[model samples]
Target: MTPRSRPTAGGSTALPGTDFGHLTESTRPLVELDDAARIRSIRSERWIGYPQARSVLGHLETLLSWPDRQRMPNLLLLGSTNNGKSMIIEKFRRTHPPTSLSDREQIPVLCVQMPPEPSPSRFYLAVLAALGTPIRPHSRVPDLERQALMLLRATKVRMLIVDELHNVLAGRDNARREFLNMLRFLGNDLRIPLVGVGTRDAYLAIRTDPQLENRFAPMTLPTWTNTPQARSLMASFAASYPLRQPSHLASPEMTDYLLTRCEGTIGELSTLLTSAAVLAVDTGAEAITPGVLERTEYLGPTERRRQFERHLP
Candidate 1:
């Protein structure tokens, strides 16, 4: 056969019928899958689809409505790492926008994640920054507190949701005491309910401050353990991913596999399911399958597992 003539440097060799409009969808990077939209999916049943989620939301609503209840109960949410604490708060924020709450009420739920072993001054600065208050990078602790209080007053934040409350106890005794005192003031002085969320250690930290303990209503939300609710949650999770494995949809075997892999934590399960979906999409599969999930190893090594275990049930 005669060789096809090669186009010169500037000449076009493109196919005559090529249409740029029909470009195939590119594969989305797995890392990019952790964006706010996908991870904060409230529609996913397998993860946030648990019965306890409603209970938590209801408790939050109660606090919002009865902010004046002299008791001013603080909520203590304890669970294992990867236990859906963050997701629950994210979903709550999505469904009940903070802007709406701030307009109608003072001390609306202000969700904040505490830094690991942060100082009282650092904590105050973080709160101020989170509330969008002006703060000098080198400003003094007292200045930050003044600004924070002003922002709180301006925003009308009724309740504060402090995630990873265990951080308060990570500091020195003086630091810990100061943090606790700040919490006391945020609750008693401002009369705003402080909802602290963390792993099991959060419970232990509260014990250090009896006053905080007195004001707090400890609510433990553990990972599912061989229950009907767990299966139902899995079904919901499967529904959220349009490309979820066909075998996993409401299947007992898939539920068991998910439970075993994620160790009953809806958060971990969601992460795994998302990974599996991305993998399926990359491999040109229309749906996720048991094989695809098994092929995608999302969990970490033994050392990482130990780190996660420290925050477990």
Candidate 2:
């Protein structure tokens, strides 16, 4: 028999065939590995694309190609914490990576996290830091602004993505107003699309400024529910793992249980599944069975909060 047809301990062949038809084409080869290797693979990070994420990526691509005008369009990517906002941006950034020319580096997409307590100077500093420029201590706000704008123009940044944008609300009223005005100035001055990413509070903050609210088109990534799409996502997750046997995670009963336990967030669901897959590999289950899920150690968001409160002094 050929090496591809040889049976492995996980009851799957080394390559794509009848025995490994349940898995993704790329994952089929992983099933033939030993338990330790399979466990390592299960713990590694991977992306599981879904419809919503794909739609967002498509929008981002459109934004990237938008022409520079007096009033460039913008996007507000709103979602709960631990949702896939950052990952989507990261993926987009990777797609259009920085180009190193003989003269200078050209960064088409610039992503920076909003300062926790945002001020004009602090925000400028964050931008400078993200661009790998050295910031002089005790620099004036005007100086910082000049440096940031110069670098942004020099680097030829096409899109600016500000993550944790809700942090703008953390400032006092005057500070918040100043920061919002600064955002407006940046968009107008650079004439590049600005993308804000944060929780719903980001939307609320933007609404306070009518001009910004109108300029930024809002997009949301809501929590998952028990539906055909959710089941399909679960099936994709199952197939991505290198398990020897089918996980059957898309069954109606299993889907409901998983969603209930995960509190309807893809991040938590991924955590739970990763743990279960690890347990499955370690315990010789070779699959994410119901029993394996039960044995897996995980805490849903609400339960974790309640447990923390219970232990409070």
Candidate 3:
């Protein structure tokens, strides 16, 4: 379904031309798919190796290869919610996936989510769950810890990534302190680097414990701005989609409008773009034009929350 282009008035190009040169070579063929297929392709998840994500991945690699030491270095990956912190960690984990040996599996990188209700027992349960161990209901905290640590050592996990770490603050004072202590104990016992991923609150929770605060170097993924890097990111996104014609999303005017509407978060920007791309395909626009974006049903995060509040009983 290649688009056809015709000369317009004043020597201008017409809409919906087969000028998919803007896309990556691998993605160019997708432009020929039917509208439903192209929309499905557009909705699929993909990675954009922007500079900040690359830098974070580099740091994760360094930590993964660090030699065993009494005080292993840790990292605190801080970012706004839905700003790509978890995506970066997932990408790193996939790069060094687990290896199954004759006897046992060797997990080079183990990722666990911090329990919403933070407690040592619940945390160890999360670890055990991630390791694919059967949970014993009503298991004692000590038993859970023993099992978790034993399995961690047996698997030879090089690094542990704890996502949603800001949930640590959800506990009471004593519970929080206990969880912090558990973290220190886990790191010291396993001699493996612990990476914490969450919002700024996670850093604050770490700061409460001086040792953890010192060990974990903070790295942040701030929201996007009207910068060259952001423009490049927009161009990358435009190329990733299977649109037949150029989106011109990297144009300064479009960049400004996108950043403003998406409220500067990559997650919001992605949602907005995906919705607009779907609309573009459905309406035969073949490119994400201003009209396509305007017709999308997507709403920015703030607006969605405000709308929700308005409907509250």
Per-residue accuracy of model 2 over 195-235 as CA lDDT, tens digit each = 99999999999999999999999999999888999999999
- Pull out the clashing pairs in model 2: none
Backbone collision count in every prediction? 12, 0, 0
Off by over 4 Å in 1: 1-47, 67-69, 100-107, 300-313
List model 3 lDDT by residue over 1-313, tens digit each.
Answer: 3356564554433446355689998888676666677788999988999999999999999998999889999999999988999889999999999999999999999999999977999999999999999999999999999999999999999999999999999999999999999999999999999999999999999999998999999999999999999999999999999887788899889999999999898988999999999988788787898988888998888998999999999
List pairs with backbone clashes in candidate 3.
none
**Candidate 1's residue-wise lDDT over 203-275, tens digit each?**
8878888888888898878877667787777666555553312325456677777777777776777777777
Per-residue error for 285 in candidate 1, Å, reads 4.1
Instruction: Give the TM-score of each candidate.
Output: 0.76, 0.94, 0.94
Better of 1 and 3 by lDDT: 3
Highest TM-score scorer: 3
